[model samples]
Target: MQLFYQNLLPEINYLDQDESKHCIKVLRKQQGDELDIIDGKGTFYKAKITDASAKKCRFEIISTTQERKVAFHRHLAIAPTKNMDKMEWLVEKATEMGIDEISFFQSFHSERKVIKIERLEKKAISAMKQSLKAKKPLLNEIIPYKQFLKETDVSNKLIAYVDFKNKIHMKNELSHQQDTLVLIGPEGDFTPEEVSLAIENRYKKVSLGNSRLRTETAALAAVHLMNLAME
Candidate 1:
């Protein structure tokens, strides 16, 4: 089934602008062609083409369904990088790997600030549809590290850091039953004060592995390990 994204629904007879172009002009789908629509919050509808205008192809819902939630909940918070390509790639991969929520934080040594979330949201929806997943991940607005910490609430809090002077590993520290929040630092890593503050708040220190890793790599590795721990 051809899948399309529309965040709003009860969306009676609305044609997806880009997907409509793809349907009418690219795929050349005509009226009555069967398609599927996702509202990105677990809602899936089976629809048929009603109007096939390249810019405004319309559809009618035939049936609707929702998917079951995952066995474990996850949220990954990372410092946004200076090179946006890496950050964008992280968003895509995290969505494919089944992350529940993503937050971009401006860390002490972070090189970038003021991320544009709309593009990331679009990337996430595209990845979700491509993965054939029924639930879409939440893309949070970028914020400062302190504010992010103040606002987030999770059962387990983990900070991925490599202190040559201090040793810790995520595998040994994370609890399987609790919803987790992992903080992946910037390229330069989190400042000593930031690490101290996080530890003060009960955020455990953990390492993704022994080898040194880039910020994006650490973030993705954290996501992978979290999924594995739940499994």
Candidate 2:
């Protein structure tokens, strides 16, 4: 089924400019054509086009369906890489894999201190629509590493970093049916003191695998592990 997104539902019955153009001009959808619409809030709508205007394609909802709530939440917190393209790739893939939330933090070794959250949000929305998911993952603003750990209040908190002595794999450490939050460090990795601070805050240190991975790769790996554990 072809899915379109319109965050404001019931209250609003028109697709925005971008979506309108895509539906009318690109897809050649005309009045009276049927379309599937989602509000990115776990709600789906069966709509019929009323006006095929490329700027403000209007539709009337024929039916509404609410999706079931997920059993657990998968929140992936990481230090974004200097190259935003990599971070965008991670966000897109993670959204397709059913991530519930993504948080960005700046660590002592963080290369990219600044981030464009608006751009990432667009990427996430496109991915959600492409993957045919009705719900969109929460994209959080970048905050200091310490602030993130202190503010985050999830039950299963984990930190993935390079530590030979800490041999526990994230997959094995995951608690089934519980909300989880995993931390992935920057390319330079987190400092020992930072790790200690996380531990002090009750975050368990875990490993993704034996092979060392880049910042984005490590973050995606943690996301994948969390998805698997939930399954």
Candidate 3:
């Protein structure tokens, strides 16, 4: 089914400006065409087009479907990389792979200082539609590492860091069906003090693998491994 996205639903006979433009101009869809719409909160609606204006396509809801809640809750808390494209790509792939939430942090050695959450939100919505997912992952803005560690709440906490000469793997540490949370460090990796603080706070130290990975790569890797553990 053809899918469209909107953050809020309009009550009257009006379509979202962007959805309308895509329906009328790009798709050239006509009145009475069937389409699917998602509110990005676990519900889907099948609608039939009523008006076909390029600026304002209108549709009537024909049927509705509700998706089940996620079986496993996974959150990836990471330090955004220096390249904006890499971060955006990570957001897209993570959403497509069914991530529950993503948060950015400013670590001791982080190269990026600021984040544009608005753009990231848009990218997430687009990925949701493209992947035909009913729920979109939550995107959080840049936060300080210490503040994030103190304020975030999750049942299972893990830090993906390799000590100077120590080697351990994340796949060996995770348990199934847990509310998993993982911290991925910056390009320079987390400082010894940061790692020590996390350990003191009950965060388990785990490694994705022996090979070194970029910040984004580690984030995505953690996400995939977490989902695998649940399955």
lDDT of 2 by residue, 6-105 (tens): 9999799999999999999899999999999999888989999999999999999999898777788889998999999999999999998889999999
Ranking by TM-score: 2, 1, 3
**Which residue pairs collide, candidate 2?**
none
- Model 3 weakest 10-residue run by lDDT: 6-15
Best by lDDT: 2
Give the Cα RMSD of candidate 1. Answer: 1.7
**Candidate 1 overall lDDT versus native:** 0.85
Tell me each candidate's TM-score. Answer: 0.93, 0.96, 0.92
Give the residue spans of candidate 2 off by over 4 A: none
Estimate the overall C-alpha local distance difference test score of candidate 2.
0.91
Candidate closer to the true structure by lDDT (higher is better), 2 or 3: 2
lDDT of candidate 3 over 9-122, digit per residue (tens): 535555678889988899999999987888887778888889888888888888889866777778999888899889899999999887989999999999998989988898
lDDT of 1 by residue, 112-224 (tens): 98788988988898899998877788988889999888888777999998876768789776656778999999998899999998987788888888778998989898998
lDDT on C-alpha atoms for all candidate structures? 0.85, 0.91, 0.85
Better of 2 and 3 by TM-score: 2
Clashes of 3: 0
What ranges in model 3 sit over 4 Å off?
10-13, 164-168
